[model samples]
Target: MSKKGKSRKKPRLPEEQDLDTFEFRPTGLNLKWTKDLITVFDGYRIHRCYDLTFIERAIGEGQMPRSFVDQWRFIRTILHRFAAVSPKIPGVMEKYKRRQVVRFVTLVLLTIAVPLMVATFVFSITAIAP
Candidate 1:
């Protein structure tokens, strides 16, 4: 318990870290795509792009692919489709935003409800058991 026996550790700065261990390398295309995607979401007033559920909902209508490869393909397809068109077209952007909002809200409600239903079923069964 003596103060002399205690050692304080200092946090390491980014410059102090080893460069070889840093793995993230964003290519120009990747950076551009990220920027473009952010812009699209901003236009739609959707700011939860970092959320996994939001991303899945936005790209695949809340139905996520079973495998990583399929998920990547699905995402790439959606990104390409988004990049190919202008959301500024009259009525198109509004329709898309409305659809996305509905999908996201429905998915969120279902996510909350399914677990509650399962828990309620379990409790009911346990309560009825001798």
Candidate 2:
């Protein structure tokens, strides 16, 4: 007699084998095929560029707002909205890169400019006092 506790396990399909982390990873043939196509057409004129770029979100924002999973998604939403206006590949990429530059400037402002300004002010005040 077969034991009731013993159960047969079913094999997982290809779809089920993927992990959640795989969603954000660059996989499959598109990247490789694109590189190959570019190599053939462009030859020596342009080098192959395969970049997996993602947004950077600062600390303390993770899971803060119930809606956003993280800052990356938040930044993505902003960039996506900005790109949605044009929706063309060239236009979207140009705008996205430009907007990313602006974002980087803003980050520098917060991390560097504001702190320097505060330090300068404090130093000037202390210098004037004594």
Best by TM-score, which number? 1
* lDDT for predicted candidate 1 compared with the true structure: 0.55
User: What are the per-residue Cα lDDT tens digits for candidate 1 across 20-129?
Assistant: 56343323334554575566545534322333344446446533334432334444444444554655457877888899999999999999999999999999999999
lDDT of 2 by residue, 1-130 (tens): 7797968798432332223343432233255544653453343223223221311231243412333233234334433444444545456678778999999999988998888999999999999995
lDDT of all predictions, in order shown?
0.55, 0.47
Per-candidate TM-scores read: 0.35, 0.31
Candidate 1 deviation (Cα RMSD): 17.6
In terms of TM-score, how similar is model 2 to the real structure? 0.31
In candidate 1, how many clashes are counted? 0
